[model samples]
Target: MTYRPTVRGRRLARELRRLRELQRLTLQEVADRLDWSRATVSRLETGQTRPKPNDIADLLDLYGVPSPQRDALITLAREAGQRGWWTAYADVFTGSYVALEDEASLIRTWDTQLIHGLLQTEDYARAVITAGRMLPTTEDIERRIDARKARQALLNRERAPQIHLIFDECVLKRPIGGPGVMRAQLEWLLELAERPQITIQVLPFEAREHAGLDGRFTILSFPDPADPDIAYVEGTMGDVYLESAEAIASHGERFERIMKQAMSPEDSAPLIAEAARSSP
Candidate 1:
């Protein structure tokens, strides 16, 4: 199926196209140099096909991009490839999540309500979307739910990015979709916790002190030599993308503080299991 590029994805694609033009290299010329099909290069530059690492490397060399510029391009390529499952639900969700998910090499998420998108079950996703009174038709909601399901695939990749998730105790106690849905969600969390690359923790409501109490945010870190880190904060209308060094640094510090305040993964599992037992 054809995909509509997210705003951020489109922006990145335009940047790549501009770079190519500045170098005075035609698409066919670059393709011939990389031994890749012209269509492939065209797709990458047009944001049709997501750019892969190898493709970025070849393009950088072909374009004679400097080391710093090459690294940035490669990072953008990696982010471009991260079309999260959410893209499928493009009709529902704003494009912000897809863009942020794509560029995040390491994601630190804090969930105060439903399970984080990366860990939600289909049932949980449905419940969460349906709960949104402003959402449109059921078909659109289901599409978004499915898109969220697809996004989970990234966590299962062989070289999946590191995911550190912190949840408030309310997420466990407050029944989103009800007992059955919440139970399933907890089970899914338990299953996800088994993955070596994922760390799940919960901050008990009793934890009088917590950095995340003010609000929730995610810090997305990319591989080296790229533009500095970014902070994604969501709201009712859309989301904000913060890339300034000071903003990124502040979010990083807040994430570290919240991580320290939350219970350890080892300790959090039993709590999750206990919640699951009591769920429905």
Candidate 2:
């Protein structure tokens, strides 16, 4: 299984590389000194491999990291190495989205297609995963469904993230799991909208050629300033995680524009309720 580095993992990787550079040692020199392969050293510095505490200790010793920073980084390495709930269904979720999403304190998203995954009901998720993934086995489909269910638990946690969703009008009309399933999903959306932490908006067709013509994306903000914000773009080819300040700022502007054009949460509630009631 490929190790998808989390924010802490990436931070630890950067620090390790910086420490080595400070000592003016090449990767080969470090590997030779530690009796590790050059490739192993490279992978650790690049976050391509999980950092073992012992391995991190050795690297710190080589760099003479000293007590304060050395202990801190080793602790970070242990946390980075810890497995999350999603790891159990690694085959289902092939990216770090779930892992990162688990850490977010706020989630903002714009959807041109289906409903946001967090708000999706079990049946709706099953439908989406089945049709989109083309899984060959019932067991495989169930496993994916289970993973999505686990992910939704984040919303109900004691300190759940503030979630705001802006979806195109067409998403309300698209019946993914047929009329009955779609109706249930929409009704659930209505129920969830009543929550204080959740906000929903609909971008009507009248607003033509808007900023969202590009596609859908989600921005995740963390409580810790050190973690920074993340902008995620999902694609059929592969998902993209944008962390740079410029990239995040650009996506932030796009989302703000989209939100401006979308119906207010108050106005959107009636529309969502109407869609749910009208769905037969």
Candidate 3:
């Protein structure tokens, strides 16, 4: 199975890098000192490989980390290696986005072709999975649909993330799983818009230019100040996550401009309702 790093895995990776920097040690320097290969140290710092407790202890000793902090980091390494809910669907979620999203405190998304995954209805999700052609068999598609529905549980959790979704007006009109499915999807959007934590907007075709013309992207923010915001861009080939302060700020500005071009939640709700009625 492909490795999808959990939030704890990410946290551990970040901490390890910070510790190495604090000690003013290069990857090669650490590798030589520990009698390990540079690639091993690099992978651990990059979250491509999990760290062993003993290895972490050795690094902590070399980095001069205090006893209390060393113990905490060792415990964190163990937690980071544990699997998450998405592990069962590893074939589908080969990336770390779902794991990061699971722990996000806020999610801002912009889509031009389809509804954001978090807001998609069951029928719509099934249609999307089938259309993607990523899976070979019907059983795999069904498993993906079930996994997607399970992911929606995050919305109803006690401390749900603040979700802001902006999509192109065409998304509501482009029939996905036939008219019946499209109608249900639009109706579901209307219902979801009523939630206090969810905000929906539609960018009409009338807009000559928009910030989101570049394409779909999502920005996820965590509750912890130490966890930096992530800007995720997904494509047919693969996914890219931008974590630099500049990337996060740029995406943040882009989302604000897109929100300006899109209809407000009040206006969007009526448009969705009308589209639902027109679906056929």
Candidate 4:
């Protein structure tokens, strides 16, 4: 299958292009130094193709990068090549979005509807998937649920990424899969709140004006310094990945604005607890 390159893959490609330009190394020259085909180097730099670990090491050597920098570059390339676990559930998600989610070292998520994927309980996830009329089959739905569950593992990793999530009050009021499922989901969120690495906040309905009112979006920050930040905006049809510094900066400002308007974690926890209590 011809899967589209991920946001992280494209960002890695862009960085390679920038570095090559900085060194004034033509693609042919670099390829010659590495004894590789010019087309191979070009594809990798253009994000038309993914490169293996050995390929990354060879290219870094050809670029004459220092040891420390070379190691980081290689790591970025390796990450770009690894297939995301979501790929197994390719029937459920857009490929590019899955890749971006996997590469993110820090995720700032704001949602106005249901719970975000990383925070969703199994019942909640199943309910959401069932509600999507376009989904194909029961197996497909299970695959997606499994994929989401796997993604949650990132939160439990020894070096887990930092997640800061802000949810609109409407999300708490909307009951998916009836009250039992909703209660479990809210309880799950409450438990997640206790994690030192996670930060959860809720925006009250009375906060009539908020930056996230535009819709849900996520800002993904990478471990690789050379790779630029990405903003992902998903809608009914497709998703958009924002990579330019100006675009990233704009999203960052919006995130800050929403964070300022939303309730603090201390206040938000009680709100969630109250919602769980009210659930029938």
Candidate 5:
């Protein structure tokens, strides 16, 4: 089984790599100094292997990380090795997005083709999975559906992330699972929009020159200021997670621009309700 690391794991890996670079130490140098294999050092630095707290402490001592910061990093290393709920659906998710999404305090998403996963109904999701040909067999599709439903539970969890979705107007009109399914999906969006923690917006077709023309993306922010925000872009090739300050800033500005072109939540909700009624 392939082991997928959690967001904390990735953060720990980045910090370790940064520390090595700061001290101008090569991977081989560190491995030789610590009497460990170069492969072991590489795996830990790349997040391919779970980090041990004791090993992390030893590294910290070598790097001269002091006081509370060192303690915090050790805590993070331990947390990084722990499994998250998404680990159960590893076959379905196959990426770090779910883990990061699970831990994010805020999720800002823009969907051009369909509704966001958090707002998709079961029937709607099934239709989408079928259309995308994401899974080879019915059983696999069903498991993925189950995984998606489980992901939606995050919206109801205590101190759930504040989810903001901006959908292209065409998404509301696309009938993915026949008329009934499409209607249900649109109605579901309306219901979710009523929640205080959720915000829904629609970018109408009239807005020909929109900022999201580049593609769909999600920006996740954590409650802890120490944890930097992430910008994620998904495509036919694969998924990309952008962590650089410049990348995050660019995505943030793009989202803000799209939001400006999108309808207000109040207006979007009514349009969603109308689309549901008119789906047939």
Candidate 6:
């Protein structure tokens, strides 16, 4: 099975690499010692494959990792290998993003196009996916919609992530499914804004040539500080997950600037309400 690692999975991979380097053992040397293929060791360190607890224990023993640390890492390996709900929609969630999103403690997104996916209503999602993807079959579209609904459930779960969304004002005016669907979506946004964990802001058209003009990006912050923040950018060609400290800092600053320019959640609520009332 292809591995789409969650935050814990990534942390385990980093620990594995660090331990091997600390022992001054090359991948080939470790593979030869364990009578395993070099590719297997490399894949384990790079998180290309799900780690088995037994394999992790073997590596820990070889590295002279003590009982407590070894036991901790082995536990992590087990957790990493356990499939998440996203596995059910493996075709739809072809990346680690959904897995990461499921565990994020804070989700900050800056978008110049449509509303954030978690905030989208069913009708709006259908229109957007149908138009944006040009999916050939109805089954394909519904599968994605189902996957999206499944993903949205994270917001309602106990200890839900604090979501801060800043989208371009044009999104409110875009009649995606139709006037009625768009209106309902806007009203839905107003209702969602009432929730304590969600904050919705709109960057008006007048804020031209702003920091967020570069395009949309999402920053996922995990509860565990060891995991580090990830800046994600989705594009037609592919998706990019930025983890370097410099990249995270850059995106963080840009998002702050965009937030500064955007209407406050209080002001944005009125704007969204007005948009819903107007003829689309």
Q: What is the lDDT of residue 185 in candidate 2?
A: 93
Candidates ranked by TM-score: 6, 3, 5, 2, 4, 1
After superposition, candidate 2 runs with Cα above 4 Å error: none
Report per-prediction Cα RMSD to one decimal.
Answer: 7.4, 1.7, 1.4, 3.4, 1.6, 1.0
Query: Which stretches of model 1 miss by more than 4 angstroms?
Result: 1-89
Pairwise TM-score winner, candidates 1 and 6: 6
Candidate no. 4 TM-score: 0.83
TM-score list, all predictions: 0.72, 0.93, 0.95, 0.83, 0.94, 0.98
Clashes of 2: 0
Residue-wise C-alpha lDDT for candidate 1, range 1-280, written one tens digit per residue: 4454544455567677888899888989878887889998888777776567786787777777888878876876676566555655666565465655654678888867757888888888788778864466887776777766667778777778898999899889988888988998899899989988899999987788778877888887765443356688887777787867899888899888888888999999999999999986
Tens digit of per-residue lDDT, candidate 5, span 47-159: 88878999999999999999899999999999998888888888888778998899999999998998888889999999998888666789988998999989988999989
Whole-model lDDT values for every prediction: 0.77, 0.92, 0.91, 0.84, 0.90, 0.93
lDDT of 6 at 31: 100
Q: Model 1: clashing residue pairs?
A: 85-151
Q: Model 4's lDDT to the true fold?
A: 0.84
Q: Which stretches of candidate 3 lie over 4 Å from their true place?
A: none
Best by lDDT: 6
Model 3: ten consecutive residues of lowest lDDT: 1-10
If the candidates were sorted by their lDDT against the true structure, best first, what order would they fall in? 6, 2, 3, 5, 4, 1
The residue-by-residue lDDT of candidate 6 on 124-181, one tens digit each, is 9999899999999999999999999999998789899999999999888778898999
Candidate 2 residue lDDT tens string, 1-280: 7787777887789899999999999999999999999999999998889999999999999999999888999999999998888888888789889988998889999999999999999999999999998989999999888888899999899999999999999998899999889999999998999999999999999999899999999999988777779999999999999989999999999999999999999999899889988888
Q: Residue 54 error for model 1, in Å?
A: 21
